[model samples]
Target: KTTDILVQAQICAALNRHVIDVTTPNVGLQDWSNSAEYYQQSPCNHYAKFWDQQGISVDQLAYGFPYDDVFEYSSSVHTPSPSRVVVSFGPYTDGGGNDNDEDITGMGGNLSVQFTDSPAGEGFANLIDNDAATKYLTFNSSAWVQFQANNAYSLSSYSITSANDAPQRDPLNWNLQGSNDGVNWTALDVRSGVDFPSRQQKQTFQVAANSAFTYFRFNLTNNSGSILQLAEIELFGEGSSSGFSQTIQAENYSSMSGVQLENGAGAEADQNVGYIDTNDWMAFNSINIPNSGNYTVSYRVASEGSGGELSLDVNGGANVLGYRTVPGTGGWYNWTTVSHTIYIEAGTYNFGIFAQTGGWNLDSWTISLASGASAQSAATAFNSENSMLEIAEISLSPNPAKSQLQIDFTAEHANLTLLNAHGRLMESTSNVPSGSLLSISHLKKGLYFLQVEIDGKVTVKHFIKE
Candidate 1:
């Protein structure tokens, strides 16, 4: 399949796993493999609640993730007559509360935009309507838009999009300011002589926000023309609880010195950072280590040769965290997860991943509070497959298993049976501990079910042999 197709499949799978819909806010999952009859139950649980939001469509099908079209969950509406398509604009409001459509600030949609130093009737609501065609136009050369979140956020980065037309009206100089109180503002990021070559072009800038702030303002100092117009502004940051786990794709760096994205060969991993050289680094801004003590950082990497090492640091090496030596995984496309625990101070940082030695590809990385990380057990990791047979006690890892399938449960003595797609018994075992690795190297690549029975209670889990 093409990258687009694979990405769509991944998005559909992610949405299904999370059970995200209009009513529920993704509480927990009951199954992982099946979502055909998922909506039959009310208040379903979902995954990735931090970023994913319910769609605006009547059916609640939206593209919360990048690849959400695989199972037709995309908000993109198709029609036979493209020329006849018409989009309706909203009934504008004057700087009132806004339901965070994307949860971009991680503030649970409880945010409002306040306009300052701008003439009346500038249509401030259009600034964040997710529509580039509509704009917040003002005759004034300088303007400021303040975003107020319910909780203080350690903002890492922000983006500004140019209006649909009039290049001369684009902003040239701007300052991103943060503040606890709206009166006292401190500049976090400043840019001058900025250019927007294309219309509706979005440029993201990293903010050196060390502390969390309740209010953030975009101070547009100067513009190319007397009439300044802007399409939209977005803020990215972390909220009060930094204990939650955040997984970031290696290719999705805010900035990079020497790195490139290539097609990933691993299961569900479509892209990865490759062609890394020694001293080459990638920067991910606004990584919030809220009152951090011990945090576990895991990286999914692959290398064909040894001597490759990855070092992690914060804020241009102002604080060097640690380094991990990469072991050869036989092939450049082969992948494995490696982790390390490191202590960090309470602050927001620009996390820098440097290549101490070359010859490895990085797919992704995850950071979680070590103190709260253990709460996520295997069962919690892989939520649901069949709700009717859903057993919260048992869980499986690497669902699209290549070789060994890990079964995690606390059952003292459980009988395990593996059956192929046709329900014919293939493998059987007895008396396995909580963390047991079952070898299925001989099994063919296809759909299979693992039936686990403990104390006369039977539970079936669905997995794919990749």
Candidate 2:
């Protein structure tokens, strides 16, 4: 028969007999009597015969045994069923020990119990007794709890209260630590000397894996040992992290109505205008003007003493306009409006008010576009080139002329183009006689650009037709 058939037959024989003699003396005992005798001698002997038949030695059988009971009997002595298993129940004195009887009673699974003396002395026994209502652990002093590394965890909220009626402890403390391994830890934050009775505070900590930390802990550095307190701790920021940009506008002040002012004296003091001391000037943070136009500026100023004079610098176009001084009004709060009209060219300009006088009060300043008839008169007299160009002094005899408009140029020869408001050429003339008068009597009344090209340079003079 094949080895497989022979093994199968042996297995069937053992099963039918309901016992396998693996340790029968290798005297080649094939008889049932010899196998039973070997098994009776010892379980290991039976196991040896049974395995030897399969070409396994006693040691191999011992090593390869699947059942623990079989392996134990093969290597050690066998004990009969005992009446009871020894168990130690607690320090029944304070009712603070584990119940060992539960093991033999089979009421619950394997029970091994011990009693540890209460760290707290005296009547504190009730506090440590493992009863349903009173079982709790208390740390009368500062303590630290360590958590496993590389894992995210949270803390439970805790409270601290003063034990004494009076303030025995002035401050309490707590801190948090994170660690990659159990041994090395990094302190995240610490709070010290906290007044527990007055304020209840809570804190949280988030430890990142990138910080090479895997553990976290809370250390109660100090606390008032009066009442039981706890804190709830939570962990976040496991996978995401978060961060700001600011835009600042350039400082400028150009508008007529939006001028800002700063004064060190009383509210009724006049403002010192013109010069801007970097330390005392009120400046605008930005200049966003819609369009540029001629702006008129005026300010009120006064000095502290009779001889006290405040000088201010008016700046524009890469240069100072002029410095003006305000004479004193002879009293502490005395003030006056010393005003001037400044013709500001069309463009954004930064300006500020500063005082040179030691002790003076300045206040109520008004600046705006020249009003009404003065504006019209000023616009009329302002020359385009004011004698700089060789063009004949342009004169409109009767400026509010009803009919013919006259123009004169001093050049021997010139090119001229009378353009309408939109700069469209309405009339053009070349080789104009020197000091000769040109007339445009046919045009209707409105604004026009009298562009005169003299010696290849263009000078545009704005005028109105009557």
Candidate 3:
């Protein structure tokens, strides 16, 4: 069985990996290290009671002492608490005699409690427990326990513990407010209810909108005669911004024509000349080129036409380069080698291959740097069928000549033909130029191919008529 292998030329670019080093400015490294170390060990529990104290008011306490001294105070107050402590304040007056009548109006009945030396005070442990004592104190009607507001905050939940042993007097009333600049205020929520003696109850409020407020306050309107206690208060909301990063991969193949790898599949070859139709080509993976430089492209070709040629253009775009042609060797399955070095910039470039004349087969095309600094010469040995052709030595003079042409061949008998751009035979000479010159100054100014046939082997050389 015989098979025709259509090899499409593949052009690609690649970049090597690079390493970069970054350095920081020299400064007081000691200070920077100390600050970082200190911050790492700082207590995050500090924010737990961030809103517990603000302005001149105290909202809540971690631990408190009871009004009655019947219970013994534990020496180990540093223990963790299952719940937070609360403090309630109201007016207490002493009786006294009225000046106009004999009635006692100004009695020494007014009483008040100060937050002093109790585990429930400002300097208590980071956390409190349920077994902790609840602190309650009497105050004048003009007196109020200040609760700190965390800017504008939303309350998720709150718990209140009352003294069951004490008798209740006035109903306990509370109101929530937000303040900007810690002065102007807006009401958020309010509630009034009878106090539970020596019992715990929880209240929760949901915020409508997320806002920025510096001050929040929980005002106590009326406190039941019995001292009040609060177990815990919690506020929740979104606080920080989120970030995202994305990566993009770009490829450019606009400079390519006849042969191209579309959609990252394989290589495609165009057999017909003129405008190339890319619909019949194979796609391949994209190449990544780092910087612009010079590269040598090589490919295998097998053609059966007496004078068929293929044109390959590499790095074709605003700045085009790498233009060359591979001539037909008149045998199928005969591999021919052609190469060209082109300077390309650092970018994705497109390459194209077109059949200048008749159909041809292409295979194993690769672009890489030449072995040495000089331009890479054409291949001298190619595999054809089961044998390799040791290319015969042939010479052409005045390669960029203005008019004359010369050639030297080793074969005793040979046939030579000068063909123009349209594949039309311009001139033919036989058994001559074995080592002599052929004059033809009348030839038009353009590109032409010199075909020399010796035995069954053919050699094609390109010349420019300046």
**lDDT of each prediction vs. the true structure?**
0.64, 0.37, 0.37
Q: Which tens-of-lDDT digit does each residue in 183-238 have in candidate 3?
A: 68777666677454433333334445535333445555335443333432333332
Pitting candidate 1 against candidate 3, the one with the higher TM-score is 1
Return the TM-score for each candidate structure. Answer: 0.33, 0.21, 0.23
State which candidate has the highest TM-score: 1
Looking at model 2, residue 176 earns an lDDT score of: 63
Better of 1 and 2 by TM-score: 1
Residues 19-120, candidate 2, lDDT per residue (tens digit)? Answer: 565677762455442222222222243333344221122221232233322312343334698676664542111111122101001000111111222244
lDDT of 2 at 2: 83
Candidate 2, after superposition: displacement of residue 433 in Å?
Answer: 38
lDDT score, candidate 1, position 275: 90
Candidate that would win on lDDT = 1
Clashing pairs in 1: 8-70, 18-46, 18-47, 30-384, 31-384, 31-385, 32-384, 32-385
